[model samples]
Target: MIGSLLYLTASRPNIMFSVFLCARFQADPKESHLTAVKRIFRYLLGTQGLGIWYPRHSTSFKIVGFSDSDFAGCKVDRKSTSGTCQFIG
Candidate 1:
């Protein structure tokens, strides 16, 4: 399931964080982790129309990116998690 979700993240970037979070417990997942994964699936099902689209023809191209990170956000390993996204227009 984690592998499938990771593949889907290539197009559905919105669920990347949730999917990766759930993946951390793959070796010893608890009931709550299972519930979280289920919730992510439901979210994807309901948001099927949401995704990035690129046009074939364009005169001008612009690139934009944003990134953020937290300090020691992970309770289990006390590691910071960071995320980044880019857009082209």
Candidate 2:
């Protein structure tokens, strides 16, 4: 479930953080994790028509990229995660 949601986040920035938070618990998912997943699903259901849009007449597609991560943002198991993206100018 979470995997599918994460995949959708590529075009749905609004749910990125929430999905990331829930993903940290996949090692040993608990009831709280399940609830968070439900919340994400409800959110998607309520915003089904929502989506990303890029203007067809935008300027030259100059690209920029950045990334950063904490070794253990989640205090549970000390696993790390990274976020990166290329932005157009």
Give a tens-digit lDDT track for model 2, residues 1-89: 98999899898888999999999999999999999999999988999886555677767755689998888888889899988987866
> What TM-score number comes out for model 1?
0.59
Candidate 1, 1-89: lDDT as tens digits: 78989999998878899999999999999999989988988998998887666766866867799999999999999999899998887
Clash pairs, candidate 2, are none
Segments of candidate 2 deviating more than 4 angstroms? 51-89
Q: Which 10 consecutive residues of model 2 have the lowest summed lDDT?
A: 52-61
RMSD of 2: 6.5
Q: What is the TM-score of each candidate against the true structure?
A: 0.59, 0.56
- lDDT (C-alpha, whole model) for all candidates: 0.89, 0.88
